[model samples]
Target: MDPIDPVHGTATLLLIAAAAVVVLLFLIIKVKLHAFIALVLISVVTAVAAGIPIADIPTALTTGFGSTLASVALLVGFGVMLGRLLEVTGGAQVLADTLVNRFGEKRAPLALGVAALIFGLPIFFDAGLVVFLPIILTVARRFGGSLLFYALPAAGAFAAMHALVPPHPGPVAAGTLLGGDIGVILLVNLPIALIAWYVGVYRMSKVLGRRFDVGLPSLLFGEENDGTGSSGDTDTKTQAPPTFGLVLGLLMIPLVLIGFNTVLSTLIESGTIAEGNILVDGLILLGNTPVALLITVLAAIALLGTRGGRTLGETQQLLDSSLGPICSIVLITGAGGMFGGVLQISGIGDALTTSLGGLGIPLLLQAFLIATALRVAQGSATVALTTAAGLIASQAADLSNVQIALLVTAIAAGATVLSHVNDSGFWLVSRFFGMDEQTTLKTWTVMETTLGLSAFAVAAALYPLVS
Candidate 1:
C-alpha cells in the first residue's frame, strides 16, 4: 500500500511512535506479554493514534507482516531443518572433535569456537548451544578448567554470527527491509563476524576465563559420563558418525551457491555478463537464498538421513521437529515487520528522518543507537533488529547497496549488545554453564557488549570507505 499522507504534524507523529515503543516494551517486559501479540496490538493502536484511517489499519498490518514473512519464513524454516539434521546426525560432534584434534588440547577453546562459527551459520544461537553442550562439557571435563574458558568463546561465536550473518532471522529481516542484497550482507559480514568474534569474544574471553573460574555444571551430563565421555546420544554411538569433511562440505553448499548468485548478479549489473543466458539464469535461480537452502536441506536429508539407514518417514519426523522450535521466532519477526509497516504508513518514518536529520549524527551511529535502545528495552535481538530496520527504511532509501548492507550490520551490532536478564539467551547461557545472575551479568553481558561494539566499529569504519 502507498504511504498514507501525514494526517498529523511531525511533532505528533514522533510522539505517537515513541509512545508506541514504550507501550511495546512495557507489554513485553513487565506485563509478560508475548512479543507477537504485543507488536500487533501496538501496530493497531499506533496506526489509529497517528490518524491512519480505520479502513487502512488491517492492510497496513498485513502488508508489513506478509512482506516480511515472504522473505523470512522459508529461509528460517529450511535453515533450521538443516541445523536439526546436523545436530541429530552428530555432524556437530564430528566438526568439534576434528577441530580440537588439529588445534590440540591447549587450543581447545579456540577450536570449539571455530567449530561453532562454522556450525552456527545455519543454526540459531540457542539450538546451536544446546547441540554443542555435550561436546563443550566433554572437553571441559577432559581439560579441567574454568567453564568460561570453553563456554564463552563458543557461545560468543554463535551470538556474533547469529546477529551479524544472513540465513539467521535478525540479519535477514533487517537486510530485506533496508533493501540490502542478502548475498552481499552474507559475504561482507562473514569476515567481519570472524574478526569481531576473535577480538571481542576470543581475546576478551581469555581474560574473563582466567578471572572467573566457573566450574562445570552437572545439568546435562552427570559425573560418571564425564569420564566415559559419550557423544551424548545412543544413536550416534551405534552408527559411524559423519566425517568432518562431510559435515563441512554440507555446510559449504549453500554458501557456495549463494556466492554464485551474488557474483553473477553483480557482473550482470556491471554489463560484464548478459543476463538472459539459460545457464546463467539457471545458476542464479539455484543460487537464490531460499532455493539454495532448500537444495541444501534436500541434500542433507539424503546424505545425512536416508543414506544413514533412516527411513524417509524418520527423516520427515526429524525435519518436522526443527520447525516447531522456530515458530515463535518466525511469528515474532513477522509481527515486528507489521509494527514497522504501521510506522511507515502512518508517516512516522518521514517525521523521524526530518527530526533526526537535524541532529547531525551519522546515519550509521543513529541506526546503532536506535537498535540498541530497542534491544535493551525488549530483550529480543530479532525484534530490535527488524523493528529498527523498518523505522529507518525510508531514510536508507537512497543509499548504495554496500551502504545498506553496512546499515544492516550496524543495526545488528546494536541489537547484540547488553543482553541482560530480559534476554532469553542470557538465561540460557547462565543455566547451561551453571553461572548465577550476577556472574552472568559480569561475564556474558560484558562479552556481548564488547562483541556489539566491535561489530559496529567495523561497520562504521567501512561505511565511509564504501560510498
Candidate 2:
C-alpha cells in the first residue's frame, strides 16, 4: 500500500526526514536499542512528524511491513532451510573440501572464496559464515598464515553475493521496490558480481593479509571440541558426507529453473512464443523464486536427509530449528521496509527527487550515493538498499531493463560499503575472526569498501552500454 502524503512542502518533509534518520541512528547505535524496535519506533515518529493522519498511521505501517514481508519472508525461510540442510548433512564441507583440493594450498583463499560464492547463493551472510567457520579455520591452520588470508576472501564472497544478488533479501527487496525484473537481475548480476569479487575482495584480501597478522583462534562460539569441520552434529557420526557431485546438483537446480523462466519470458516478450502457451505457463510456476526455492528445499531434504539416512522427523526438526535464529533478521528486514514506506508516504522521496533530480547525475550514481548515505546512517544494508530504492522508485520508471538491474546493483554496492561500529556486520566479522575493533576496521572494513566500490565501478561501466 503506497501511503498518501499529508505534508505537501519539500522543505518541511526534508527536515522531518533528516530528523528521523538522526533519531534512528541515535536510538540504535548510541542507545543500544534493538534494530527492529528502533526502526518501528522511528518509523512511527517520522509518520507523525510528517503530518500523517494519526488514524491512518497504522494502515501505512502495516502496508509497508506486510508488503515487504510478502516477498522477503518466503525467500529467506526457504533459503535458510536449504542452507541448513546442506550444513547439517555436511554438503558444505564436501563442497569446501573438493574446492580446496582442486585449487591447491597456495591458492587456498581463492578456492574458499569460489566455494563460498556458490554456497553463499542460498545463505545469509551471518549464517553462511558460521556454517563455514570450521572450514575457514581448518584451511588457515593447514596453511599457517594470518587467518585473514583465507577468512577475508570467503567472508568477502558471501558479503558480495548477498549484497549484489537476488534471492538474498537485500537485492530482492530493492528489485521489487524499483520494479526491476528479478530474472533479469539474476542473469546480469552473475558475471559482474564474480569479477567484482575477484578484483575487490580476493586480490585485496591477499594484500591486506600481508599487513595484518591476526592469529587463528583455537576455539570459536564456545565450541570446545571443534576439530571436525562438520556442523558439530555428533549424530552424523555414522552418516557419510554427501558426494560433491550430489551437493553441486542440488545447488544448481534452482538456478536452472530460474534461468528457464527468464529465457521463456524474454522469448514471449519478443513474440517468438505466445504468453499463454502451456509450456510457458508451467515453466513460470516452477521458475518463480519462491517456488524454485521450495522445490530445491524439498529436493535437499529428500536427497540429503531421508535418503541419506536421517528420518523425516529428524529432518523436519532441523528445518524447523533453522527458523529460530533467523527470526530477528526477518523481523528487522520487515521493519526496514516499514521505515522506507514511511519515507515514501511522508513525501521525503518526492522531495529528494524534485530537489536533487536536476543535478545531472546518472540514476545509477544517485542510487549509489543515497544508498551509501543510508547504510552509513543506519548500518543495515537491507534497510539502506530498500530505502534507497523506494526513494528512487519514481525515477526508475523510465529506465530500460538493463539500466534498472544495474541500478539495483549500484544501490547494493552502496549498501555494502563501510561496515563500521554501527553496522552489525562489523561486529559479526570482528568476533568471528577474533580481531579487535581496530583490526576489524583495518581489515574487514577496508575489504568491504573495496568490494562495494569495485562492484559499483563495474556497474557504472556497464551503465553506458546498457543505457
lDDT of each: 0.78, 0.76
Clash count per candidate: 0, 0
Query: For every candidate structure, what is the RMSD over all alpha carbons to the true structure, in angstroms?
Result: 7.0, 6.1
Model 2, span 1-467: residue lDDT tens:
55465456878877787788678767866787976898799889888888888998999889778876776678767766777677657676677677778998688888889878986776667645655665676677556778899999899998988898876778878887888887789788877889889999999998999999998753232232343545465435356888989988987777677667756765675467987889788997897768888898889878887745678888887777777766765677678677777777666655655565467787889888888766654466887789889988999898877888899989999898987644656655765577765688789989999999998999999899976
Residue-level lDDT tens digits of model 1 in 1-467:
77789989989987887788778767876787876788789888888998889998889889878977786678767766776676557675576667678999789999989988986776567655755665676677667779899998899998998899987779888988988888888899888899999999999999998999999875433332444334353332245768878977877777677667756765675467987999998888998878888898888888888745777887787667556756666677677667777776776766655565456687899899878866764457897899889988998989988898889989999999988644656656776677765688799999999999999999999998987
Best TM-score among the predictions, by candidate number: 2
TM-score for each predicted model, relative to the true structure: 0.65, 0.70
Poorest stretch of ten by lDDT in candidate 1: 220-229
lDDT of 2: 0.76
lDDT of residue 152 for candidate 1 = 88
Candidate 1 accuracy as TM-score: 0.65
- In candidate 1, list every pair of residues with a backbone clash: none
